[model samples]
Target: MFSSLFKRDDTFYTLLEASAAEARNCAILLKDVMTHMGADTSSQLDAIHQSRRKHKRLTQEVTERLCKTFITPLDREDIEHLSSALHKIPKTVEKIAERLALCPVQYANDIVSRQINLLDLGTVEVVNMVGALRKKAGMEHIQDMQDRLQHIEGDGDKMLMDLLRQLYNGKADPIEVLILKDLYELLERAIDRCRDAGNVVFQVVLKYS
Candidate 1:
């Protein structure tokens, strides 16, 4: 009976994966929003918000499970930290979506699209990293994945700087410049959130390995 009762709740990994998937969904939706900036993208924005909320619920479940369970697949703190990191990705993506909805159509240029693509790639990688936790992959493998996220985040930082440099060239409209700057920073942040989640997973592997 005790074996059945204490069957090692692995559902925490599942919930974390679901949260990571939601983060990826937000990135995908953000891409769609970028492509259709001139069109009414309220629906896409709504979808991103919904994904963030879903991730929030997953985070809550993780916390609740931590409260009820004595044993876990990972350190309790690692699980909580990872859950928080994953939740932030979608939350940040939702902010990006909101900003994109309000951004001027003319500013939805190729650079913005490239940045969003980078964001999407980062979130996808984050999902992979979280899922690998359940598989108990080797530290080297998880570190490789984490290193990719670091590179993606570095690229995002460079892209943001490039965008800012262009915006500050003194020829652009001041108001639009301000709006674009805010959006670009938010994109950078979302990518960083993915990197942060990767770092958490890599640390967890290091602990167990």
Candidate 2:
């Protein structure tokens, strides 16, 4: 499974790793914006957007490789599906960062921080799962990481509920409520992107294992 996937170096694996790294970077940038909401984060937000664009290019390369190359490290449809899934993690994170940039600093709190932290963990797991294709990792290894990603996503969901509980407590400003709710949902969706990508990696491994 491992040797056939990439021989530790190839265009598909290389591009997948690059896209996964960008996804991880976008997750971290989103965390930074939440941690420093009071400060100017125009540069950091711009970087998040760039990561999304970079992933788009990588995905396009995967499609081009599919057309030009005689064979792929994995099935063509699997490569396309995984590439598309990997790109969504950073793409969704970009949206979350945009929402946070406009949100008031007074609303930022431990819950949002913990949620973003989980999001970071999720993307990191995604990077690990993708890299496993080139690392000769056992099926158990990737599956374990996939399980962890799912756990992180579940934690994010719990935090979302807790945030809703706070927002609906009736003492908060209506406008603040709407903004934070939007931000919370976006963060959860970002976490979902990671879990979804990890699932794709897991399925691919299962096919070749």
Candidate 3:
């Protein structure tokens, strides 16, 4: 009876993991979209659309579970915040794909590639952080993952700055400049969304530690 009183459900953790997985899926699709710079992006956009739908479903599951569960492992507010952050990632990635599809740019550099790599890496860390909630999570371990997310976000900022500098160097076509600028900003925002999710996990660990 005593053990039952302290028993915690793993459903919340599973839902969070599913949401993180969707974010990773979105990143993968975004990376694929970047690889085929001038090719048709319809398939990639469809994949991201599917990923966004999956994420939305998982988030809704979490919300509905929250309403039913009397005792959650984590605070209600933290769960909602993290769910919202995870959803934003794929949503932003979908927007990026849509923009690229509307106005395809032929770039000759690896700036976008580097950003996609960082965004994917950051999403991976977010996944790890979310999974940590299932185990006897160590504050130090969670901090390490959070640190990785922060590093990715910082690198994204530096990369965007350098890319923008090149864009304004009066060499590339003005139309290309406009398209790349929009895509770069969206990618950076996606990375920020990853960071936001990581921070929520970190805060939850801190609160429960």
Residue 167, candidate 1: Cα error in Å is 1.5
- Whole-model Cα lDDT of every candidate shown, in order: 0.88, 0.86, 0.86
Alpha-carbon error at 108 in model 3, in Å?
6.3
Cα-lDDT of candidate 2: 0.86
Q: On residues 63-166, what C-alpha lDDT tens digit does candidate 2 reach at each position?
A: 88777765577877988888999888888888888888888788887788888899889988999999998776889998899889989998898889988998
What is the Cα root-mean-square deviation between model 1 and the actual structure?
1.5
Clashing pairs in 1: none
Tens digits of per-residue lDDT, candidate 1, 1-209, equal: 55744668899989999999988998999898888798999888888777778778888989988888877888889998998888888888888888889888988888888889999899888989999999988888888888888999999999999889999999989997988898889889989999999999888888888
Q: Quick one: best lDDT, which candidate?
A: 1
By lDDT, the candidates rank as 1, 3, 2
What does the lDDT read for residue 5 in candidate 2?
42
Which candidate leads the pack in TM-score? 1
| Residue 112 C-alpha lDDT in model 3 | 73
As for candidate 2, its clashing pairs are: none
| lDDT tens digits by residue: candidate 3, 1-209 | 55644557578888999999888988888878877668887888888898899889999999998877767788889888989988898899889778767765555257777888898999899889989988958999999999889999999999999889998999988988888898899989999999999999899899899
* Model 1 stretches with alpha carbons more than 4 Å out: 1-6
Candidate 3 positional error at 161, Å:
1.0
Q: Each model's TM-score, in the order given?
A: 0.95, 0.91, 0.91
